[model samples]
Target: MSRMKIALAGIGKIARDAHVPALMASDAFELVAAVTRHEPPEGARGFRSISEMKAALPDVAAVSICTPPRGRLQLIAEAFDAGLDVMIEKPPAATLSEARQFADMAARAGCVLFVTWHSRAAAAVEPAKEWLRGKEIKRVEVSWKEDIRIWHPGQSWIWEPGLGAFDAGINAFSVLTHILPGALTVEDAELRFPANKDAPIAADIRLAHAHAAPVLAAFDFDQRGPQTWTIDIETDGGRLALSDGASAMSVDGEPVRLDGGPEYHLLYRQFQALLEDRRSDADLRPFELVADCFLLGRRKLVAPFEDF
Candidate 1:
């Protein structure tokens, strides 16, 4: 079988650290070109933009967009118009409306459009999901905290009004949507924004299912020591814990082991499968939850944070 030639847009940290290595390891995909305003790192083919890359590498079958959420719709639309299957990174777009637009365009174009939730590809996630089947859920709690200076460094887009901790927060929501019993909507939230920025530095969210359970989610980007990404669920059977952002799982008191690698590898594998089956994998639930939280949540101004 011929490999799918793929181009990567927004060759930033995520593209370099996750997508690039995953594509290199996958026999199903060939990294034909990359589009970025910035320079591609060593040993990588570069194009100034996605349009330029499509013009030069017409054989490229797919494009994975790793750009920030604020401007993703136009890029995905352009890719769809070019008849390229598109895979967008998490928090598919800046708003739920844009995500719907992309879904409609992808349908009209008859191409695969995958909204990648990398955390869903965590090795232990599916197993945990399986274990939760038919179990009665009591409550769900998610806490994801990390130091932005350590993780993002000089990235400025995250501080923009439409971006920020919402990106990582959506990832946690994505995993919840995948493993939980059903859909949920935000009931209440408090977003804490740094005095100097447009976006929130932390968020406390409450979510509820139709009649079954309630979920409490907390996200903090200013955490200083021993960063955390954990989800704990209380069920009639026992307690299910997913730590390290779903990369590690434990049930009751027993630990579950998982194959270790960057989450993008499994994501690409699923993307390839979707392409092969002539299917689309665009799920907007996670993004919708975050957007809803922002729309309805109360806002609080917090003291300015600095890296020291």
Candidate 2:
């Protein structure tokens, strides 16, 4: 089969670190162009906008949008208008209403739309899901914390209204929603906002399922030491833990061997499969949980997060 020509819509950190490399290595897709407001990556043909890219590279079949959530709705719409399939990064849009429109727009255009939750593609996620089946789960604890100075650096947009700690917390939510046995609803939440920023810097969220097992999550953007992205589950059988962003797992204190290259690689492979099947995978469970956290959370002012 011929490789599908695709354009990357944003050339930021994730684009450079993950998406571009994945596309270049994929057997099913080819990176033909880039659409960025800033200078594009070296050696790649650059375009000012999706419309311009479509006008120039008429043969580009799909676009992978790597832009921030606030501005992605319009970009996805433009791609659909140009009769192109789209694959967007996590935390799909600024609001649930806008994210909900992506599927409708894709359907109207007869194009494939994939709102990817890349963390769910992690090696341990599926294994943990399989291990938990038929077992009685007693509790779940998620600690997703990282230093903004390290991960985001000078990216001030992280403190924007729709992002912040949940930008990283949502990845844990995505993994939990994928592996858990049932649905979860936010029971209570405490959001710690920096005095100077519009978004929260740390949060404590409590969620519940019908089974009554408590789900506790702690998220922080100000950690100074080693980062943590761990989901520990206490089940009747034993303890199941996914650490290092679900790249590693252990059950009953024994390590589970994992096999995979990178999350983005798995994501593109799934996108290719979706395109082949003419299906759209826009799972909204994780996104909805984040929205609900904001809805039920009480705000507390913390020290001003003035730096990166």
Candidate 3:
């Protein structure tokens, strides 16, 4: 199959770090142009917006929307209306309804739409999922703490109404939704919001699933040392641990060998599969879990989080 001429919309950090590099490495995609408000990335010329990019590069067949979660609807809808396939970053839209609308629009346009969960593409995820297929889960604990300064720098959108710690926490949920034996839902959540921001800086969330175990997760954005994204689970059968962002796993306190590799590579491969098969793969489970955290949980105000 010939390479799909694709455009990169949004030149943010993830766009530069993940999407651009993934597309460049994949044989299925040809980086035709880039749409950005700032200086374009390394290889492609910049366009002020997706519309401008589309107008200038009509040959582009697909676009990857890497913009922040807030107000991503219009750009995605516009791309669908223009008859171009789309691939969206995590937390596809602010709400489940809006996300469903995007999926519907893509279906109507008969175009490929991929909503990515990069964490699920990690090396140890599939192994863990296969290991837990029919087992009875007793309990789960997630410690997903990271330094916002190191990862996000000064990007303030994460502190806005929709993103924040959930930006990183959602990756844990992505892995959860992928590896779990059954459907998971938030029983309740305690969201700690900084006195100034509209989003939470830390969250203690309780999650439950039918016939499965209870889950306790703490999503913290103020870690000062080595970042931790680990899951410890106890089952009727044995114990499992997933650390290093689900790139490594262990069973019964014994290390498990996984094909430790880059996740973005797998993500792009899935996107290419969606394009080749003419199908849309948008899983709303992770996004819905975040929305559930906001809806079913109570809010608390904490000291204003000031980054140095």
Candidate 4:
């Protein structure tokens, strides 16, 4: 099969850090152009906007959107209407209705629409899932805390209404959704919003599973030291723990390594498979849980956070 001609709609942090590097390394895709307000990187056509790219590079078969979560519906609509497949970053949309809408539009248009949950594609996630296949979980705990200044310095969208705690927390949900044998529903959530920002700076979420005890999660955007992204679970049989956002895991103190590395590369491989199969994979479980966390969770105002 020929390499798919792909363009990037937004060339921000994740795009530079993950998508561009992954595409450069993959034989499945040909990086054709980048649509961004900033100068596009070398080896790809640069356009100030998607409109210009669509007009000039009509042959580009697919596009990966790495923009902020807000104002994505219009972009998705236009891409699908132009007969190009789309791959979206996590928190695909700000609302559940839009998620359903995008999935439906992709299905009706017969274009591959992939919603990537990078954390789910992490090295240890599948192995953890296999390890916990049918074990009865006693309790589950997810802890994700990182410094926003170090990770997203000056990015105003982090403090915006659409994505804050949900941005990072959804990654936790993604890994959890992939590994757990059964489903979970949000029992409740406690969100800590900064007084000056529209989004929350910290989150305490509760989840319920039919076969498991209460699942507790803590997501915070204010951390001073080395980052933490982990999921620890106690099952009826033994204990399982994932560290470094599913990059590594341990079962009863035994270190387990996965077969691969760098989740974005694995994500592109799956995108290639989706295009070849002429199908779309836009699972909404994780996003829906985020929505549920916002809708059903309690909100508390904390001291305002001032980022660098």
Among the numbered candidates, top TM-score falls to 2
Best-to-worst order by TM-score is 2, 4, 3, 1
Q: List the residue pairs that clash in candidate 2.
A: none
TM for every model, in the order presented, reads 0.96, 0.98, 0.96, 0.97
Question: For residues 98-127, what per-residue lDDT tens digits would candidate 3 score against the true structure?
Answer: 899988999898988899999999888999
Model 3, stretches more than 4 Å misplaced?
A: none
Residue 244 CA displacement from its true place in model 1, Å? 0.5
lDDT of each: 0.86, 0.91, 0.88, 0.88
Model 2 per-residue lDDT tens digits across residues 94-167: 99999999999999999999999999999999999999998887999999999998888888778888658999
Task: Give the per-residue Cα lDDT of candidate 4 at 282.
Answer: 88
Tell me which of candidates 2 and 4 scores higher on lDDT.
2
Question: Residue by residue across 108-192, what tens digits does model 1's lDDT show?
Answer: 9999989889999987788888988898889999999988888788888878786477777888988988988777889999999
Least lDDT summed over 10 consecutive residues: which range in candidate 1? 36-45
Tens digits of per-residue lDDT for model 4 on 1-308? 77889999888888998999999999999999998887786799998766678899888999999988888898889888888899998779878888889989998888999999999888888889889987998899999999888888789877778669778989998888888877888988999999998999999998986644889999999988999999999998799999998889999988986687788899999999998898899888988888889889899999988887
Candidate 1 global CA lDDT score: 0.86
